[model samples]
Target: MRDLNVCIIAFSSTSQSVNLYKILKNKKYNVVMIQTPCTISAGCARSIELKEKDLDAVVNEIKQNNLEIKGIYRRVLNDSTRRYYYSEIDI
Candidate 1:
């Protein structure tokens, strides 16, 4: 598969992850819950994608709702292998 670099939002609890998805979806954010990729160590089996520009807003929302998140991640591509790699984001 080709490299798919993306910013993903992860949670510690599956229910909380899905709940955030519903909230973001209702707000019309380009978010989707998917099976957690092994590249990133998270607290749940499910994860969601969030836009970079929306990071601050999403963070606020998450905090306002008292949701605990594992962290954000950036999916990077290994040029030599042309495979995807995951890197943890401080935010």
Candidate 2:
């Protein structure tokens, strides 16, 4: 099995999602902007993906920058089922 790295940032609005994406992207992380996955919902229609190792910094940026975050979720994709397990983060 292979491991996938991602961070699902649930924002209060699409605009906020875009802002978050910009901030993360500027940090030069492997970021991908996408809609909230079908199987998960933290109240955001948009999300950004980054390396798992960068999760802490990203979370810190959001908090430090006072970004409005609905929630942040981590996931381990079930390769066989091609689905993600939504889980919370302590940060």
Total clashing residue pairs per candidate? 0, 0
Q: Write the per-residue lDDT of candidate 1 for residues 1-91, one digit (tens) a residue.
A: 3335467877788888988888888988887788888767634899998666777888888888888888888777888788877778786
Give the worst 10-residue stretch by lDDT in candidate 2: 1-10
Off by over 4 Å in 2: 1-3, 79-82
Candidate 2 lDDT over 1-91, as tens digits, reads 2355666766778887788788877877778888787666746678777777888888788888888877777777778988667676666
Residue runs of model 1 more than 4 Å from their true location after superposition: 1-5
For candidate 1, the lDDT comes to 0.79
Candidate 2: give the clashing pairs: none
Query: Deviation in angstroms for 77 in model 2?
Result: 2.6
